[model samples]
Target: MDRKLQRSWMMYDWANSAFATTIMAAVFPIFYNSVAANNLSEGTATSYYSFTQSVAVLIVATMAPVLGAIADYSGAKMKFLRFFAFMGMAGSVLLFTVNEGDYLLASILFILASVGFSGGNVFYDAFLPHVAKNEEMDRISTKAYAFGYIGGGILLAINLVMIMKYDWFGFPSSKEATQVAFVTVGIWWFIFSIPLFKNLKEKKVGDPTEKRDKSYIAIGFSRIGETFKTLKYYKQLLIFIIAFWMFSDGISTIIRMATFYGSTIGIGTNDLIAALLITQFVGIPCTLFFSKLAKWISAKKALTLALAVYVVIVILGYFMTSALHFYLLAVCVGTVQGGAQALSRSIFARMIPHNKHAEFFGFYGITSKFAAIIGPAVFGITAGLTGNSRLGILSLIVFFIIGIVLLQLVNIEKGEREAKALEDPREFVKVEVK
Candidate 1:
């Protein structure tokens, strides 16, 4: 509940988002398509980028639960977070070395960076409940996303200027300017991370128990089985996770693929990056506004409203043909993208047993990451077969629709009630969270 602690925790979101904006969502996709994959056809390059994203998520999906289990017992969430953050930073810095026609290297580095980003997020998310009380979760989560947008937007704007006007930065060409931007993402991430590591402490993980006979890896695999057995006791929360997987996949795909998809259809790099910058700046206020909306209408209804807007965005993306269209679509997306995700995260945190935050969030991460795989793969394959990425955009409508349906079924009150009567999976003994 301390303001300083909350602000420190949120700063991680601000720091890491630079990489999200500059490397993942905006600049690199265009750079990859035009430079790294220069020799390949547009469709092939897009397909390759999509597949690499899938592979990275898959790898992280496999790792999430085990690390979560270990962190639960060891209270090593911060350690795991530090490791993945470093991995992401290294990947970002290494990206500066890529040269023309180095698509293979680019794919490998992207995969490495993506894994680090998603993997670190699992632990970062686990810290949410620890950082805020139940009542504070929604506000803090949305505020965190707002901070991300602002931090990421500032960096992207600077990078945009550098790439568009290389002479101002003393670069030999825009290519060199773009390469330095990649290094900046790494530097920005590391510098901003200092506050959280220095200021916050891991207060508790779960209730203390005797040391396990098994290794953390072995416990991780066993916990997955045990967690499923416990699912019957918290059905509403399980349903929410399923809904999150469906909708989150769609949300992630749009963020990951939008720039590349635009470039594939012939939008200029500066315009593509510019529109995304608009999304970032617009998202800052909209994310906070949705947090307020969650208070006014409840998190569930607010999230549902956001998902509804996404359906409109995807359909519009299908018909997008000009820079103005992309810019308009970006504005629409900024309005709801962070709101849906931030609300979903807070709602999940409230429903899960507080004693098992890391483990449940781990399961949450793995499922969502695996779900993330389907969207890009679907888009890539759909585009590859049809030879049109716009159709791929059209195809995402089903996910949001399915998610909205499932979300309606979640009874938040019931989930919170079940969480309060916590059951220790190790013994099936009921202990109230207090």
Candidate 2:
């Protein structure tokens, strides 16, 4: 890909990530549970929130594989991206329409938006191979994530100011300002995606071979079946997937539950949002630093280091009894969060067959969605059973440990050789079809 196109593609991360920072990670959940569901009891609101998030993950997990297969088969990744992007933006815009007592409406819209956000990532990740070479991928992927953190942080900072300084804008309270922030995320997401549509080439689908005898949907299901059947053949990939599923579960749990945990510990809302904003910005430089670190240390070792940091963070959470401690922990998490995730994506992309990028990334999406489900479910359940939410937070250490152990078993050189063999120019053709 040309430099312009690569930059354009990366900018999409800048565009869509505001939603993750402001709405999903930082502000909107608290707004929904506290302001939108103000009429409901605390337990009921928490239950509704958890249920909605789980439903969204379930839908994504069920559909992502098929959706990815179709994108690969059709060679219409950008088209699929546009479809999901619209869904996400539209759902976000609908958030502004939610009233204080409209908990169910808010929950449903949030679920829709979450599905769109996660689903869009499947196609977005598939673009990595198209845009970058193996040598450049880790840096490019990490840079995109770094840009995402900056973008998300910038928006969250502005939103935080808006909410904090509501009286200056003639808004009656922080809640009203927060409603406006939801609208801004929708607008931001929609506006930033335009560059990708304009600049990137649509990947061309190959002409069907004479032996290819299935309808597209049939091919999709067959491919999915093949993927599962061949899982054992790719031992390193399978192991990495399991490791990603486990460790990312812990990461997702911490992100999704952080606000609630802060509230449970009597931290103020503004303080929690401020801490999250700090993480977003802090993640920017750290992401870039870790990308460079990957060149000196292996990506796997770097990720292991990040997971070690997570273990420390989880341990610290057990001892945190004050807002200052939460702030300190947030800074530590910010340093590793973006870098760890970016390296994971790049590493997995390195292992998979580029010809079937979307199909494999679809499986990647499935693991991510399923992992999201597992983390929150386990955290919520353990928190309920123990009547001590911090205990649930601490339980995440086990996931990090397991993931690190599994990661060590993967032979990176072997995985690279297999991918390169699949990509041998003499063995492949780029036949274009109408």
Candidate 3:
């Protein structure tokens, strides 16, 4: 791809991250608990939040792979991206209207936004091979993540300012001003996505001879079935997928529940926002640094290092009794969060057949969504049963340990070789035609 197109594609990271920052990381949950669920008891509010997020994951997990397969078959990646982006943005903007004592409405909007956010990522990951070469993918993926942290941090910082100085914004209260911040996230997501839509070319569909004989829906199910059966053939890729599933479960749970956990433990709203802001900016440089580290050490080893950091952070979080400790833990998490996730994407990209990028990335999406379900459900259950949120937080350590054990077993080089061999014949045929 040309430099302009590559940059345009990366900008989608900048565009969509505002949703993750304002809605997911900083504002929505806090506002929902304090205002939307003002009539509900504390336990009920927490349970509702957990249930809403889990439901979104369940819906996306079932649909994402099929959607991805269809997009690949029809060469409709950008079209699907636009559709889901609109859904997410509309859902985000709806949050602006959610006032106190509107718990049901708020929950529904959040579920819509969460679905949009998670679903959009499937197409976003599909664009990787189009924008960068094999050697450059790790760096490009990491840079996109770094940009995401910066973009998310910048928006969150502005929202924090609005919340802290509600009178300046002409809002009646901080809560009301926070509610308006959701609209900004929606607008930001829509406006930034324009460059990607304008500049990035959709992947060209293969000739009819290369196209699958079945209908897209039929091919989708068959591909999924084949993927499961073929799992035994791709030992290294399967092992790595399991490892990613394990660690990502822990990571997703932490992202979803951290703010709520802090609120429950007496951490002030300002403190929670500040801690997340710290993570956002801190993640930028660390993401870039990990890209460099991958050049020296393998991507898998670099991921292992990040997981080790996660173990330490989760362990420390378990012992956190004060706001200061929470702030410290947030910083630690920010340092590794973007880097680990970026490397994970690049590592998987290296292992998958290039022609089937979107199809395989669909499976990646499914695994991530499913993994999300387990950790949060476990966290919610443990928190409810024990009445100690710290214990729930601490349980994440098991995920990291198991993920690392599984990761160590994956043969990265072997998987890359296998993927290359599968694509080499097709590439040679293309060259002959040219």
Candidate 4:
């Protein structure tokens, strides 16, 4: 079971999640609005930040499948993972240079850093099937989410204190502390990633005997084309991906837009932030609890239960009336968010052709990004038309509903059997290159 190897892979989650917390979620948006966009209105600053993030996401989502196909060809996952991780870390450190009236520079670095973070995760996810056996997938995946919660939560907690009590940290103001927080994310990410690079090795799946003459770039596209044509052989897996896309969109929309919705509706910023922090800490234990729950019941049932909870949460969100209500919703989200996502990853890992993890997880990444845009767009449109955020929040019910319906159609056992039947995994990448 290679406990050391599994832990090393999980540590990468702990490492990079600091970027998710301090840089992406908690500290940076506030810093960007106040310091980077010093002369701009708050609305304008937020708009610019959103635009920059969208740019980063577009680039990564476009590149993911090709990169994944190429990595699968020659045990290149580790190399690619290292390169993108460096990009993310470098961007985080460079954010320290941002000062008042430097929104352009801050935006550029944010785009680069986030691109790196998202790009690196494609390969990091590719390691899942290699690190753990079939029976261990749920435990390993759920625990990784738990590790992310604890690690990211700790750093964010420290950064919050640093900003709140800037004088105690010997900084001139909160801005200086915020800039330093960016550097801390970079250092923390790099230091924790060492264990992964040192301990885990990418298992080679490419065929040396079956040779091809095309450049990797061309071959990457070729591989994807072949994957598309042959996807019918993996029908259950395709159904699962569709289901995942729909539900994950709902989850991402809630995560990305919740604070803004809360702010728009008159909830205090401090209460919103504190409530979110509770989600992080509560997520740690609850995510781990799902691992045991999955073992007790089954991944599919556990995930179905989680999605059912999300439905209730959204309905409750429609009627939410106070800061206290928001806090309760945050707790509800914290309880199921990690479990649903963790189980999704593990379930996908179990279903795909073993040799094509990198290639397929790439698609997983892209679907997630694209689906992410839909919920927010729908929410925005609904809110705009109705002049109420409640209806906007309620609109998310459609995503979860469709996702659960499609999820029930996926035959996981048949999918696993189909995946196991593929022996010569390079049928398209090598011998059939014509």
Candidate 5:
């Protein structure tokens, strides 16, 4: 394995995670509420934020797979990654100009930034199979998640301090500090990303001698059609994707809506923020521990164990009535969040052909975004009908249960064998038109 290349790949996670933490998770929502939506009620501000999030996810989910196919056909994975990264960075930098009553501008920039973040990740994930050998996938993936935790945590802590000590920085208020933090995130993301662009290379796909006249875009659409028609032959992989979609939806719902739920149950904003920080820092060691655990017990079993824990957490969430309970739930989620996700990526990496990683991981990205839709939608519907957030939290358990059931049916070894059998992996399977 090329250690330097592996390190470079991991650094991209470290780089982009600042956007995850500082922009998406912490500073931006609060800034949008206080500054951008100054003319609106708190509830209205939150609704606008949710609207922006949904729009961004919708755009990326629709684009990921097509772009992935195009990247594979054109050998332009790096080019796509660069374009998205710049889009995200420019959006983040532009956020510094947002002021009171600028909700429209804020939402637009956020959507662009989010599209960049989510879109860039499609290519980043595609590089995994290229950068790490089959045996090394677990370790490399977990290490990247760990780096994300550490890097994101450090920057978030700094941003927090800057907000709290705005006076020391000659800022009149926390709002100014928050705006500066947005600019800082853009700089941090861009600087750390330089290594990946400099060091990592996209693996070529398809036979060089097999020439076709199809334009890259045309081939991209054709590949998507081919992939859909051939799904029947790859039963295990298809089942795994379904199971992953369900459980990942549950996970994403919990992450996205946890704080809001906590507030409804009487947890203070400070407590909620602190609890999330705990999840971030706690995830660092736990993610690395899962790497070792996967090596000892296999990725499938480790993931199963994580999903089982999630079932317990959601059930407990139904009964949680105190700040301490919320904190405990946060810890439980922290223990498995990074580990489960990292292992899932590695396991999927091992089951797919290296040549089609870009295309397949594009599907992976779409499933992830789709999950973002499912969990939240279910939770919202349940909460609206029952008038209780606990029941809404409990509804997520259904996703975990169904995911576990489907995951049990997947034969990882068999799937790996089938995927490995394809010499021209880009073919996936032969397409037949009726």
Candidate 6:
């Protein structure tokens, strides 16, 4: 492995996770609720938050594959990554403009930031197969997730302190501190992303025998059509996607809505932020544990264990009525959040043809993004209808249950073999990563 390149790739996680932690999980939801959407009812605020998140992901889901295909056709994966990173960074920085009763502005910026985050992630994930050998995929992927936890956690801790001690920072109120934190996330994200741009090279894409029009846009669409035609040939990979789509939706909803849900039920901001901190700090060690467990048991089994934990967490969430229950639930979530997501990335990387990593990972991104749709939309609908958040939380179990059952039908090794069989013979011989 190229150690520098690998480290560079991992640093992108460190950079972007600030968006995940400070903006997505900890500070912004609270800000959006108490300030931006203060005009709305508690239930409506929660629904709007989830709905905005769903819309952001839905936009990315529609474009992921096409953008990926264009990148592959033009050998411009890094360029696409840069564009989205900037878009997300700009959105993060602009979040400082959101003031009380600025729900519309908040929604627009949040969606833009999310699209940038999710879009950049598609290209970042595609780099996995190019940088790591098949045997090293789990370790590398987990390491990236571990770095994300530590980096995101560290920044969130600082942001928490700033919010707590606003006077020391010369801010008159916690609200000002939070607005500053949004800007801080943008700076942190951009600073950390530099290494990936500097060190990691975009692998050449588009096979020698493949034909395409002069326009990359046309070729991108053609490539997607061809990929669709071949989907049935990779049965295990397809099965894994179906499984991942369901369970990942459940996980994403929990992360995006937990604080809002807690707040809606009368949890204090202090306790909610503290619980997020617990999840972040506790996740550091737990994520590493899953990486080791993957080596011992296999990535698939480790991921299965993580998903099982999620199912348990969702069940517990339904019964949560106090800070203690919320705290315990956060701890449970921390144990599996990174592990499940990282192992899924590695396992999928192993199953796909490396030459088409961007395209396949685009499909991976779409499944995840679409899953974002189902879970949050369901939560929003349930909450809107019943006027209770507990039902919304409990409803996620169906996704996890369906995911676990479908996961059992997938055979990772067989998927990898099938993918390899489809690769160009000469290229396969030149770099026999397996």
Backbone clashes for every candidate come to: 0, 0, 0, 0, 0, 0
Model 6, position 56: C-alpha lDDT score: 93
Residue-wise C-alpha lDDT for candidate 2, range 304-420, written one tens digit per residue: 999999999999998889889989998999999999999999999998877678888999998888888888778878888999988988888889999999999988777766655
lDDT, candidate 1, 26-120, per-residue tens: 78877898999999998899779767776887899888887887787778889899999999999999999999999999999988888888888
Off by over 4 Å in 5: 208-212, 423-434
TM-score of 3: 0.93
Candidate 3 C-alpha lDDT tens digits along 237-341: 788999999999999888877877888889987888888888899899999999999888978899999999999988888888899999899889988999899
Where is model 1 more than 4 Å wrong at Cα? 39-44, 204-209, 264-266, 380-390, 426-434
Candidate with the larger TM-score of 2 and 5: 5
* Tens digits of lDDT, candidate 6, 1-434: 99999999999999999999999877888799999999999889877986798789889999899889888777889999999999999999999999999998999999999999999999999999878999999999988998999999999999989998999999999999999999999999999999999998775665667775568777778879888977777789989999999999899889877887998888898899899989988888898899899999988888888998988998889888899999999899999998999999999999998667788899999998887667877998898899988999999999999999999898999889978887652443244333
TM-score for candidate 2: 0.94
Please give the RMSD of candidate 6 to the true structure.
3.4
Question: Model 4: per-residue lDDT, tens digit, 1-434?
Answer: 89999899999999999999888877888788888998998779878988987888899999999999999886799999999999999999999999999999999999999989999999999899999999999999999999999889899899999989999989998889998999999999999999999998776785668787899899889889888977777778899999999999999999888888888888898888898798999999999999999999989989999999999999998888789999999999999989999999999998888777888999999998887678899999999999998899999999999999999998888778777765355453333211
Clashes of 4: 0
**TM-score for each candidate, following the candidate numbering:** 0.93, 0.94, 0.93, 0.96, 0.96, 0.92
Cα RMSD (Å) between model 2 and the true structure? 4.0
lDDT of each: 0.87, 0.85, 0.85, 0.90, 0.89, 0.89
Q: Evaluate candidate 4 by giving its C-alpha RMSD to the native, one decimal.
A: 2.6
Measured by lDDT, the strongest candidate is 4
